[model samples]
Target: MNLVQLKMLDAIVRTQSLSKAANALHKSQPALTLAIKKLEAELGFELLDRNQYRLSLTEKGKLFHREAAQLLSAQSYLTQLANELALGNEANFKICYEQLCHAPQYNDIICDAFRQYQSTEFSVSSGKRFASLEQVNTAQADLGIGPWFDLFHATGDLESMPIGKLDIGIVCANNLVPKRVKYKQLQDYPCLAMFESEMSFDSERLSYSKGSAIMKIDDIATLKSFLISGAGWAMISLAHCQSELDSGLLQRVEVLDREHTFSAQIRVFRQYSVHHGPVARAIWQGFKRASEQFIND
Candidate 1:
């Protein structure tokens, strides 16, 4: 079947009405109906079920919709690649993050690697975590560095390599702690939390639990600012706070009777075709070498 027909089918399934789908695709309702009729006749299956103003996909249609999305994505990638080739050597790269990259040590190492490989010649910018990943999967980014969540593994063709791992900890102001602190004690005091879209571990969803009025912040900069100012204790990456920890600017507040540590893996995932580029190849090699030495040290 033609790509247009498949796209129409996906749109109908997504929008759930023939008129809505037609409006979305910018096509007349009758034309869309004809396309859908021809597709169903050719495939010999009922693709959609309509009831009044609503439409629902049949089992076969649902299966086809999934495959259609991937096919469309691949086609879009090919079109972008052609456009990039027309633009000559001004390559582009995107970096996405769940939180702002304020960790001086990690940032320096990444920037050093980019300079070592002359990656600075290319374009780089930060975006929201999932949007950044979508750019990478769509041939928009050469590399992505961010925190790992369960949904990250579901990207079909993107290969992920966890370059290094760092543990997350609670960052408390110096005056707040003379020694180790207890997790139970946090219940008695105000705490700050950074909220991302989907909470990964429901049973262990600590922030949502009843405690001393949790303050929800959307960005890392504000979260860190509040913590350093002693607004409240915050959960943060140890690697990000290492220098602060050593300098007495920030101290680790041990909770849960033990360290509540989660490993943050700096992963690099790329499309096989994109890896063929000179800049992409150099950055890959540099990150690999640096990650090895980082873990060992």
Candidate 2:
């Protein structure tokens, strides 16, 4: 009828006596007898044979006991799993990173975290521009690695630590633009910009030039494709296009404007919440250590 009743039945069948079962279970003999009686009455079948000298299970009792044992085992495992979760063992950990933050050190850190928490499922995804920040802020991801912008500082809900700096400059296909191109001259060619819902064409920052033929791209890979095809010039992270630059597939365009080249702090961030689990915390600490080593180097 219930776990208590099923347990009493189990103890009675095991000990072969109600008195002994009561003593083993720390319940009164009368209480054990009543529990069995109630269970038999509820099931419309006797679980114990009264005619036997030593108590033995009825034929139906054997089948019920077998199934009840499985339930007890499942209940035990469930209880243990709940306790583990309560202690901050995450079952699934998700991480979102921007394309610029795709470095070997970061991959190593994530692999280390996965090895440390082998039972936890780890998911890694690449996002464009501020996509990582949006994912972490909206609770779509547990952790995020991306370039830190001043706007992120204004969002008090996020806790971030700078991991390193990424150099971003205007780049285009070889021979696509003049070596010493003026800022205004860039408007003659199409300009590629990372697509953000709130992005404005009026801003001169980050490759957005006013009066230029603007091409909005959703991801870094596609933007690189366009750049390689000489579709346009864009502000891109040097780290992301290193191989291309090395092979002369892409070339950095020198701009007369001083702000053409700048360093952005790459950071790991998470939403401020008490619900962050042990695995997430470990990964965050790993990033912090990596950041320290990067700074020292």
Candidate 3:
């Protein structure tokens, strides 16, 4: 009926002897026997066979003992979790990142940094630049690391900070886009882009060249697949495609009037309402450190 009685029963099952069980409980053998009888009476079942030479639980007693062990385990976990939360660990921490946030790099650095918040349940995922912000703002994520956009404004209580920048460039396979380029000239060929919004589309035209033949692909890796197959030329993060560019598989295309290499700022975002405890703040600092070391160059 109580934790004490339950634990006593557990000891009895483990020891399998009334004398041993009593020794463990620091009580007399008769006292232990009486307690077991009372417990069985309360449960309306014969928990042990009095006639058996060896101490053993009846079928029902075995089930009750299993449930008791589970209850004790649950209590222990709950107590540990409560203590951990009181000590400033997040009960559940969700972090969604932009696909280009260099997950492997963070894994090397932040994994050890997160050890301090041992009780904090942590999870990580990757998505588009906007999806990262959206996840943090909607309370789906405690934090987000994404490629920053100058025009994308994160309103409400969400706080965003620029951790670093991603170096990117307009690239074509085998220098096929042409050496002498104009914004208008690119309009003649298919341009791969990530976002589909009219403003983003307009920004694309205005930033690089005017174009309606632009294709929208949300994923950068997939876009690279298309570009490899000679689908079209598109602006992409140089950090991601450096190996291909180094091996002469792809080449950067520059406009006649503008520089070819450009960069997008990378930012970390979190909601003000999310509990930024000492551990969470420490985690964020660790992220900043990793970002700084992962320079575009």
Candidate 4:
């Protein structure tokens, strides 16, 4: 009859035993029995058959349980709407970034802003270029930070803010490899590619050279590992592999500029469904300021 009594019945049906339902709900067996009996008395019908060792819902009980579940769902939705209006996301603030985006700026924007909103949990993750964009579009992410490729600029119902720019560099590993290899010659070797964990959209095309053998990995760190092992080659931002390049563990492929390498526009974005919360807004501003200050360098 009442929501509380309905919830008690729902639990009883789920666990299939009054004692088990009491234990699950952390209420005394006497209290749960009285609540259910109280509802049955008001309805002029029995909701459960007491003869069975395990709780079994009567035909009337099954109908009431369906309605009870809908009520609970509505309550949850109302609570979420209230939280959104107040701009307090009790759930985790999730933002996905592509590896090519500047890390320092991301750190300052995310870590620093999250500290200010200590009550909320923060989740940081990386994905392939297009996946980051899709996360924002689908509202799985509060924001997506990554290089600005043509796919991003062309996306509808999404808003973007430029953070910085990075040159796409073709890199290979080890001292044994020559200073420069012809673009076409790379076709014989395995080419490392960054594949998105979620396959929503893809616009990745042949750049510099086409590889005959492609090995796709979803993570950048893993791709770097393959590159360092001399397993294959990949196009990554020079900044990400700078330390390895300096240590002689990796080298730029040194292909001619005419081969169509790209300079990427690093940026951040959010969807058009709703405005970002205060925490997300602060991080966006911080990212812009960091870009102007060259914090990425």
- Model 3 per-residue lDDT tens digits across residues 1-297: 788788678778866788888887799988888888899999999888667887888899888888897886667557646765686565767888777656466565457756766777778876544667667755578788877775556343666666677787888787667856877777688877776322222345343545447777777788898887778897777888888888988887877766767777787878764346665688778777755665534
Q: Residue 295 of model 3: what lDDT?
A: 55
Error of 1 at 292 (Å): 4.6
Tens digit per residue, CA lDDT, model 2, 143-212: 8898888777565378888888889889999999986778889879898987663222213364457788
What range of 10 consecutive residues in model 2 has the weakest lDDT sum? 197-206
Give the clash count for model 4. 0
Reference-based lDDT, residue 278, model 1: 45
Spell out the clash pairs found in candidate 3: none
Q: For residues 52-121, could you state the per-residue lDDT of candidate 4 as single tens digits?
A: 8778989887887778867865775576567867756545688888777757756767888788988788
Highest TM-score: give the candidate number.
1
Clashing pairs in 4: none
lDDT values, one for every candidate? 0.65, 0.81, 0.72, 0.74
Q: Where does candidate 3 stray beyond 4 Å?
A: 1-88, 113-120, 149-154, 196-209, 258-260, 277-279, 288-297
Candidates 1 and 4: which is better by lDDT? 4
For lDDT, the strongest prediction is: 2
Q: How well does candidate 2 match the true structure, expressed as C-alpha RMSD?
A: 19.7
lDDT of 1: 0.65
CA-only RMSD, every prediction? 5.4, 19.7, 18.6, 11.6
- Ranked candidates, highest TM-score first: 1, 2, 4, 3
Candidate 1 ranges with C-alpha deviation above 4 Å: 1-5, 8-44, 48-57, 66-70, 98-142, 149-151, 177-182, 198-210, 256-259, 271-278, 291-297
lDDT preference between candidates 1 and 2, better one:
2
